[model samples]
Target: MHMADALISPAVAGTMYVCSAAAAGYSIKKVRMDTDTKKIPVMGIMGAFVFAAQMINFTIPGTGSSGHLCGGMLLSALLGPCAGFLTMIGVLLIQCLLFADGGLLALGCNVWNMAFYGCFIGALLIWRPMMKHSMTKKRIIISSILGCVLTLQLGAFSVSLETLASGITELPFLAFVATMQPIHLAIGLVEGCITAAVLVFVYEARPELLYAGEQANTRQNVFSFKKTLAILAITAAAIGGILSLFASSHPDGLEWSIEQLTGATELSASGGIYRMADTIQQATSILPDYAFSNSDSVFGTTFSGIFGGIVVIVLCVLVCRLFKFFSRKKSS
Candidate 1:
């Protein structure tokens, strides 16, 4: 759930922005120190994949609202908490500045609630304890699903808390929570199942890829390169893009719940915070958030994807080079 600029006060937004930025900075620092070069490509491509996956919002059957996959926990499962956390920042930044999915002011809160919790609390907590075991297919599937579900649940709670703290809605604290949590529970289940499927696929197809990925990722304290990028592209194209065309078209759990509770598909934000968020979102999402739209000609669409891929490749290489430099300096 993206919080509109109108939903939060400037103070709250500013504070959250500072906190999320600090966290991102900390993650980057840790990655640099760790010296895992393999993770860079993995992080970049996975970020792109998340971007692609989040594009088509699928309506849960029987619900009028739609939901899309948020890949934070899934990434965390493969990339570890720190790399997962940092990559999430990259994904959210793309979504905010380019896709206009969430408001600029409200972006800090969205990242913190959705990504940070998933990477740090949800993925790390579950992955670390579970990965050491024999990690059978069933166990891996079940655990990944649970981690995904827990993260989303926590994220939904954070949103409710943040909204109330901002004093945006007239709904009481308990009322807001009561409305948010259960619906997210439904959403979380869907996310968990999808996460499990991805995890299982990776487990079966590229067991060593995961092993190699974790070993190569200096940032685990994680790193990866072209191999991971290839997987990311294939998965995004196959599962995220092609498969998404056939996803359900009913309202997602969140929207459905909002409609039931608020009597509207969306509750308009009247506060100053919401207004600022709306303005920023409109500014960011001027064109295709992920794919080429009618606004973009065929040539434009091809150009954008190529340009996007090149940008991702460059960023991955740069991050890796920076880390190597830091490692050399530290060792020297």
Candidate 2:
């Protein structure tokens, strides 16, 4: 759930920005320390895939809310936590700066709430533990479901806590939490199933990719990394260019929660910080709401999805390359 500027205070936002930055720095260190550079390109492509997947929000039955894949666990399952976190940063940044999907002021909070728990907690605590002794289709399915569900629950709780800490009197803590948790539970279940399917496919294609770092030395290469990347790239293009057109029109879990509480999807925020953040977002958002400024055609939506996915891919690749360069320099 992407938090808007209205739901966060300047103090809370600033604090979260610092916390998320530190987390990113730590992840960068971890990634750089790992010698497997092959994951860099895979991370970039997975980031693009996640960017595209998030565009297609499926409706949650009986809830009047829609939810999309967060892709944190999926990335971690393939790339490990450090790279997964970095990849999510790319996805969130592109969505924030280019599409204005989430508020600029709230970007830090969104990154922490959505990415950190899934990347670290889901991957480390649930997925790895479940797959410790061995890997199987059953283990993958169970871990994916449980990991996704745990992450979403934690993410939802984090959002509620952040909002409450920000002193948003209109949204009482208990009520806001109650609404966010149940809705996201439904969302998590759907995401878990989708994640299991993707992981299963990848496992069949190249099992080594799932636990790359741990099994890199022992596992034989059954498929080329380039081939897997090609398949995923095609999948991303198809999802972003075609399936995004059919996304459910209902509000997402966050928006639905706000609407339930206030009868409106957006709240008014008039502080100087809020105004400044809003102005900057408006200025930078080239494809606001994932469509051209004056156009709402299918072409515009399709173009936005593909273009956004490309942007994420490029940004992630560049970031990974930069990290690699510095890592090499440090070793030298």
Candidate 3:
């Protein structure tokens, strides 16, 4: 869930930003030690895929709430935790700066909530133990479900806790958490299924692409790495270009939860930090809310999806290359 600036105070925002930045720094160190540079393109492609997938919020049955794929588990499964975490940062950054989908001030909270758990806990704790030794479709499905549900549960709780810590909002901790957990539980189930499907496809096509496949690629796969990347690239383009048009119009899980609490999907908070962040976001966001500034034409959403995906891909690739550059320099 993307937190708005209104939900956080400057102190809380700054705290999370430092925490997230530290995590990113640690991940970069780990990635430099990870000799498998072959995963760089996969990181970029999966980042784009996750970015595009997030644009289409699937409706949760019986609840007015909707949710999209968080992609932490998916990316971590393919790229390992360090690379996956870095890739997710790219996705969130692009959404924050370019698409205005998340608040600039709350960017740190969003990254911590959405990316940290999925990449670290989901990958290291759940996916590794479940499927590391024996990679199978059933294991993939189970790990996907468990990872998404557990991490999302933690992420939702973190949101409530962050808000409570911020003290800007009057939402009761117990009630806010009570509402957030269950709705996100539903969202996680759907995302898990989607994630399982994608991972299964990748496993069958090129087992080397999976985290466990580092050693599990003993058997030959039909599709080459290039072929698999090509397929994923095409799928990402199609989803962002075409499938995004059918996204649910309902507010997402976070918005729906706030609406349930206060009967409004958003709360307004005014302060120097908030206004400055908003001003920077407004200036940088060429496509705000995935639409043209003045028009609601379907093309704006389409353009945003494609353009955002490309930007994320480029950003992730650049970050990966930067990490590699430093790694080589250190060796030389």
Candidate 4:
């Protein structure tokens, strides 16, 4: 769930920023020490895929709310936790500053809620333990579903806690939690299923690309590395460029929760930092709300999805390369 600036006070926002930055810093250190160049391309393509997948918000039946694939577990499952976290940051950062999908001030909260849990807890705590001995389709499905569900529940709970701690909204803590958790539970189920399908495909195509696959069969599969990448790239482009047009119009889980409490999708806040964050976001957001400013062409959504995916891919790859460069320099 993407928190807006109105849901948090400056103090809470700053605290989250520090915490998220610390996580990012730790992730960077881990990545720098990693010498696996194989994950570099996978990281970039998977980041793009996640970005594209998020553009389409699937409707949660009977709830009048929609949810998109969070992709954290998916990323962490494919790329190890550290690279997964970094790639997730790349996706979220572009969505914030470029697409205006999430507020600038609340980005730290979003990152921690979305990226940290799935990359760390979901991968390390759940998926790895479940599949440590072997990798099988059934294990992949179970772990993917369990990880997505558990991590999403935690993420939703974190939102309620952060909002209550901020004390900016009039939302009652218990009521908010009750509403958020169940709806997200439904969302998490859907995401888990989607994640399973993708992971299974990758497992069949190139099991060696997965975390524990090195211990398993490394024989030739139906798909080569380049073939798998091409397939995933094409799928991402199709989803972002065309399928995004069919996304649900309903408000997402976070906005829906806020609307239930305040009868509005967002609360208004007035503060120096709030104003400045909004100003900067407005300026930097080339495609606000994933559309052309003051236009209703609908192609704007297409353009945004494709453009955002490309940007995320480039950004993730660049970050990986930069880290590798510094890592080499240190070693030499």
Task: Tell me which residue pairs clash in candidate 3.
Answer: none
Residue-level lDDT of model 4, residues 203-235, one tens digit each, is: 888888887666556555779999999899999
Runs of candidate 3 exceeding 4 Å displacement: 325-332
Model 2: per-residue Cα lDDT over 107-181, one tens digit each: 999999889999989899988888787787888999999989999999999999999999854898899999999
lDDT of 1 at 246: 55
What TM-scores do the predictions have?
A: 0.81, 0.95, 0.97, 0.97
Q: Cα lDDT of model 2 overall? A: 0.88
Tens digit of per-residue lDDT, candidate 1, span 1-332: 66556556677788889988888888777776665555666677776676656654666555566677777888887777777787777777766766565668888998998798888887667766676655556767777678877888888888777777877666567876787777777777777787778766666555544522442223221223344457667766554435555555555555555567667655665656566666666665544444455554444434444444445445655666765522533465
Candidate 2: how many backbone clashes? 0
**Candidate 1, position 3, lDDT:** 57
Error of 1 at 247 (Å): 5.0
Give every collision pair in model 2: none
CA RMSD, predictions in order = 4.7, 2.0, 1.7, 1.7
Better of 2 and 4 by lDDT: 4
How well does candidate 2 match the true structure in TM-score terms?
0.95
Candidate 3 structure quality by residue, lDDT tens digits, 213-273: 6555876797988999999999998999899999998999999999998999999998888
lDDT, residue 208, model 1: 43
Residue 250, candidate 4: how far off, in angstroms? 0.7
